[model samples]
Target chain A: MTPSSGASARTQPLDHKEIVAAPRTLVLVGNPNVGKSVLFGALTGKYVTVSNYPGTTVEVTRGAAEIGGLRWHVLDTPGTNNLLPMSEDEQVTRDILLREPEYVCLQVCDAKNLRRGLLLACQLAEAGVPFTLALNMADEAAARGIRIDTDRLSGALGIDVVSTVAVQRTGLPLLLERIPEAGVSKFRPRYDAAIESALSELEPLLPAARLSRRSLGLMVLAGDDSLQPWLASGASAVRLERIEGIRRALASRYPESLRFVVARQRLAAADRLHDQVVTRGKASAGSALARRIGAWSTDPVKGIPVLLLVLAAAYLFVGVFGAKTLVDFLENTVFYDHVVPWTEAFLRFVVPAGAVQEFLVGPPGLPFRETSGFVIGKYGLVSMGLAYGMAIVLPIVATFFLSFSVLEDSGYLPRLAVMVNRVFKWMGLNGKAVLPMVLGLGCDTMATMTARIMETRKERVIVTLLLALAVPCSAQIAVIFAMLQGLSFAASLWFSAVIVLVLFLVGWLAARVIPGRGSDFVLELPPLRVPQLGNVLVKTLARMEWYLREALPLFVLGTLLLWVLDRTHMLGLVERAAAPVVVGILQLPEQSASAFILGFLRRDYAAAGLFQIYQPYMSTGTMTRVMEIQVTVALVTVTLFIPCIANFLMILKERGWKTGLAISAFVLPFAVGVGAAVNLLMRRFY
Target chain B: MPALVQRQERCPLCGMAFDAEGQGCRPSCPLATGCRVVCCPSCGYSFPQESGWAGKLKGWLDRRKEAGR
Candidate 1:
């Protein structure tokens, strides 16, 4: 999506010939996660990309619905704030609007937070688009006893207003019914006379314009870059210079950025409309709660303690419960005892020959040839994939997601973001970046993708570094849980101390070394509320559906690759090569290197290696507890050290390969060196 | 009790506000409105409202799926 100051506007109608022979198109636009997808689903039915993440629909999603024998083309856009865009997603929103569709715009807003979203609504209104305001999440406001007067709102804004709860499909059909009516009229901004005069003169210079002349004039007035192509295309060198001259002359009279001023005026218009339409209901319980919690979560004494408690709760849930309890239950009860054994025996029964059975289950004298099964064994990708999915990872994440949902819904997470903003800033990120960090703890794969929410590319890379190095998603957290399970609470303390110290030190260092920028913290802390049980459930389900859909296929592919490696004995060859690095440099056994490979496949698998081998050593006194701490630190560091494949791919996609490779080259050696030094120090310091 | 939370007697750590009639709705949930132990937005604070047990059931199901995968 185009950033507001950079995007040039070309007002153009969509070509009917280019479109399939469908009826006129209706486009839905809104701020992020304001139920645009749900509305699309409601209107178009069942087929929308109904995932829980923001920016999930990276492109405009088009669907069709037949109403009164006419097939309606529905375009659902990514969430965006202003007509002038920032962020890639916002630019996509601009592109869709640039293609003038026939149906009126379904300008959706979260009714509870009209003040923030209405800023965009006002921009669209000023852009002279034919539109209707689709008020969403009305039930949320109504629960606070807030009432909105739709008729009054429509009159004030000069557009149709439809109050809806998209999840319930509430007022959706009514909106579809009113689309044809709202399509007949258009709205435009009223700029000051000086600006209008300049716009009128400049409008004639823009070529092949699809928008109103005033809109192009305003964009030229805004000094947006999107107009660069349009300006450069037709004008000769001299004409282009003349047009550029006009842009500069006009930029001067409007000393206040034209974008910002235009936005403020438009927001004021929306505010005026809101004032006319919304009543000051009895003080909402939600608003009151927001005020109260806002004090404590922000105040240092109570806020810091509260923040600690939250971190502790999260650690316990994702680390201890998800990793230890769930992993043990699934790996022990389900996969190890029932599924794997059953599959091995079934293979023995069917294969009919000793070598084949051994090949299917295991080679000579191993309890079960891990390589033998058709579905999951060393050779079977599907079985192993399902086993890993259900057995090793599922239970822990269930508890983790449930707890995560509760925290998110209660509004504590946003407050936590504000509290940590200062510390994170030293790492070159703002408070808003904390959301991704918290998410990084649960799953860095998802968190890395979420870092795009940060305003700048530089901030995004910094967050990515911290996520790759310091944060351990639920899977790795579980491995940590298992390692320290029987160790003294003091071990837990030591383990945590080093990780936290590293998190801050590495973040500070990366921020300084990476030469990135950071934003000042001023987050919109949403009112804390009792998390809704139902909302959390559906939301969690949607998120899981998204995770499983993205994750399982990778697991299968990873397993298939592993099978190929094992079959060719290439794993043996690679293992031998990695063993020396593991033993000679990290001072661990050759076997430990395989854990790193597993770490790439599934996050915590590397840490699980320590669990299997190290327990016997410390218990037998050949290995000291201090040694355990050192290795644990190293494994944790390395596990958090490199970007997981999923996150790495996202970075390559978003930041491009040069940045992605540079990040990896820097982090890999840093992880290994940190591990070696921390090992050496623990042996000395303790 | 910050006045905002005290007027509503909610756990400020988790903001959960509801009108009087909306009482007794998410009784069993740890983050439910009346828990007042942490911040909680209302079931009403929802695009996907947890109107009843359906919400809790979904959360449970999601967790289970998460564990399995």
Candidate 2:
């Protein structure tokens, strides 16, 4: 029968009788965006219902087609990341397989992303599903330096396999002809003895259905909650209770999630299959540029120049464009020229003269009082907090986020990790830690949370300490860049050298002190592709929204705290107490002490305070090399100071209070000591 | 419905497909509707979710390649 006879027919769901009467049903399945729908459309013509699954909003489409003289019902299911459901769509896809056992599986896969596809294929094999593998996007895959030996993959899986460019409708006829050759995959995954025993126990309890008892048992072992309905339909109360007991017992054996353990095995199997069947080749002309860049990105010898280029670009974009250009316009032209003057005049008019107006906008005759401390004070909520958050930090972080999105989309971050892996080895960390370290530059709190990806507690602790101590967050980086951009490049270099030296010294010491060894880095590098601008813009906007939500309240709260401290006379006392260290040790101005104390509240806030004191000389329109050494020393000190309050809380949550407190205890004195040393040394040279 | 049929975005590093709505740093975020950072559900790598322009550009490139073929 010709499945491609016509495109005129509209798709309709097969009635129960027709589904039952059909010779066979071919179900199309794969991970999301693997061209399953396109393949389904190619085979079934225009007949389809691409809508939510029954009784749920997860998308699933079904249609009917004639194949090999038999009317076949086609079930186009939602893309499942894994065979066992992690989300609603995955759940719907899993349910379709369990409920419709008579269907033959037609697994569509992205040719360039074979490993992930094979992970699901392994699940299908374990489930005893008769299936054929279609490696879709064959052309695009070839362009991106990927090639798969289909016959080898077929031999390895003991199933029919075909490569198809589904969008172009190439290889469809051949794929159709091989549908009859579909069979239960011969490949079977081996599980640990505990998992095996658990499967056996569950096998006997499972009711006869479309799914294999082994598959169902594995799902049960993995703690799939959605399986309850299926179990309730056929399992007795006693049997269900026994299964739960078995599951709990199995779960108790491991500290980590058992699901990940099982997934790791499947991933290993997929890797082996990939090694046996896939090959890398030269990319086409369209992708040659991306391919070469992708290679250079991970190659240590070639990557340095690429990395430098990237850093220079970032500095120019965030420092010059965002911080200098945009911030100048917003702060000088918009806020200083319009908002501050307007707000001060309005407050002066509205509030009757006396203590209220004086306190609200700061006392008259106080220099910069119109812009400085209380809610309405010159440094108050609107002038200081809003101006800093909107005019300065926002543009810098927006540019940073945009750049980050570009790197992430181009698949360069992983390559950077690979290149940095050698250096990380000296710190007793594998390349995997690079992800969190890189993320720390964006937000240390988020990076600390992401530290869970590290296999060892020792690695996590070390990385956490490094993040809290040395990494200057995106906001802080913006402020530092804004401050230093006006000064000499030597100051920037000096600041960077100190941070890198301190990071290595601390990380090395932590590695020697920590009890455990780190695991080797084994990461897959993705093919490089052109970044999608709309996607980049979206990510930038989302990150900016997150920043605004997280930072604005803190800015306002910080202003309030400063006001309270000033009111309580505590600010003067603390400044006096800190004066000796600030003046003698660090050799910084007395006012710098306040910025150091505020640094604990928010790193960016402290940096903003520094910006107010040391902005580029207005007449020269540039920061003089004047006191450049002092500025560099101060920046380095703050960069290495104790974590911000938010970050400290995260450290406590992730690593417990003792470790958190210990990290802070160590970082504070170390930061001060380094600041003193840097100051003493710089004073001699500059 | 056609517009809802988004192009599949895969993590460049791990090769995992992204659920445009579900995966990423802030899934339930109010700003998530317009945000395109498609995080890999399997691996933690986040990549920008592709737009229609990318799809159209790819199609155009593919057509040119096909003509050469």
Candidate 3:
């Protein structure tokens, strides 16, 4: 599924006259991609760079702007569709709102897509935050023939409202005119009779804070424990009794869920307001084309073939195009032609001493190429760094990021999640856990972080283990695909079968160890759209920049660390110690020792280093050896290898060291056991 | 405090149907969309409405237990 990097509307730089003196705040709130950023830049006169949120797989941008004689803190929050935020991005937006600020929130709505945007607006209203209704993308609304009466909307909503094509700077004047007046306006969330009665009882007893008395009263009634800190110690006991009294009086008068009851109260009110002010002429976003594609992608009859096509696309892009084409140019033309020779000559010119020069430039050996291994400083540095950064890892990652961007943009990934839910349930994982697993195929590091979206600790651990054991990082996948590109179809077919069997088997086994009721995956499926190349490029470049910064140093540093270990003979000692499991369990040669050693440093980098060993000296026995080595290395390294430095830091921050280390411990021996069984079976068959 | 489990029959959240060894009781929720449920292991969100009753009873008993009653 191509990532829908949604269309970012054009931005115009601001002028001095638009700058306001008094400091105020304007918060942009809405559904995904209604040109909030475009409006944000236009408002603030600040270059709001796009980036992801910290410690999670989501992003937000905050900037400064001037509006209505006030300098405002303009924040473009993560696109949240409804009151309940499911994703990390959505959670961040909610988190921001929890921090009560002196600000006017502009709930930006796409005139063409107001129904979806209004859900979140209703949530803001329920929270009783002061906000203006921004009917953004007015041109699109005009095209779609959605006519909203602003005066009626304001009257119905009991707040200031304005329409604007935020991308085109259409309604800034009117929006600005209303901002000052929005300072103290209140949005009272309509609650059902029972909860309202309960709140009325609690409100007088409640202490004052940033949130409205009614809002806090309702939170106390609904039992949002995030409000726990401010409450008196016996607050829960008191609140529970009151809530129970209300419930007893009500006697299942509402639905089973307090959450749904809350939403229904707000939604009914929003719908009534919506009916008064807005008239929808036609559907703009959801088209016949979208339905056809969506149907083909998610359902069983056609989804299988579509899934295969996507996998095949990944193989072709990373293997055939990236590794075969781009790497060849960079490796052959750029590095070989210029960087290597110059670096060698420069080292000779400066270092003077032969050993010192060799340490810096060339490896200490006769054939020269033979000396280029992971342990020798220069050879290891040049080969591993250049290869990982520019040659092999880069283009593969670029294609990967590009494909992910397209899938994200197209909005097909949600459907894929729906389809995979059934298979996931069989493995004792709920369907909701499937997204991180599918995303696991892209980057295990990010997938691990994405696990927080799961409701339970048990689900997070299961998904984390599955990711570490089964999923190959895109870079490692590129090397494997390229290495096996020459193998017979039957051999490749066998290789594919083993991995699939292991994924299911391992997932099932892990699920048993950490069993719980998986969260219900009631996700909002955004309509699929054609991926804009502009969005794709920006998204791809940003991720590539991150991947490059993340992995490149680790590549070079891993080489240097290995070099030091080799020099100290610590590596040899460890390999000798690990030899029994490495050889006896996996049944491979001692020469494959270096690959195993490098695997901890970097998975794909290690695979690339290992590939050169046999690709040149290809023989019949070597094929079996290669397959064994690849499988054993892929499985064990994926699971057991110390998480590359980036993931380790996040694990510490999110789960703490004890849980993170625990995950690694379970992975190591389990990976080896799986590898041992596979090795024995393969040898027996042959 | 951890919440109550109203269901004495099959646990919908567990993805398990009614078992043969049924604890000599029945548990059901008419509001459940399906037999399967995503019960909060910690919070017991999947419990039948009887959980509200059970929770109150348990709290009273636990207070007695703590007081050596």
- The collision pairs in model 2 are A1-A69, A11-A47, A11-A48, A370-A378, A371-A378, A371-A379, A372-A378, A372-A379, A373-A379, A526-B12
What lDDT tens digits, residue by residue, belong to model 1 across residues A1-686? 21122111113333333333456677788876567888877776643332222333465576665543456666787877666655567666776677555455788887876765666766776566677888898997786566888887676677778888988967766776666556422445466766667777776776654455566566666666766666687667876666677767766875345664565455556556665666646454566556577668866467987777877886687666766676777777877778777776776677775656654566534555334444545446434567666665666566776777888777777677656666666777766777777777667766675675576778888887778777877666665666676566666676677778888897777778776455433334455667777656665654454455456676676666666676787778877898766666677766667666766665565665455567676556566665666566556555656645676666565567898888778777777777777666666665
* Residue-pair clash count for candidate 2: 10
Superposition TM-score, candidate 3 onto the true structure = 0.58
Q: How big is the positional error of residue A646 in model 1, measured in Å on the Cα after superposition?
A: 1.9
From the highest lDDT down, the ranking of the candidates is: 2, 1, 3
| Candidate 2 TM-score versus the reference | 0.62
Question: In candidate 2, how many Å is residue A501 off?
Answer: 0.8
Tens-digit lDDT string for candidate 3 (B1-41): 11233342322122112212222111232212221222322
Interface RMSD of each: 11.9, 6.8, 21.6
Model 3 error, position A460 (Å): 2.6
DockQ of every candidate: 0.06, 0.19, 0.01
Worst 10-residue lDDT window, candidate 2 chain A: A1-10
Fnat of every candidate, listed in order: 0.08, 0.20, 0.00
Residue A499 in model 1: shift from native, Å?
2.8
Cα lDDT of candidate 3 equals 0.60
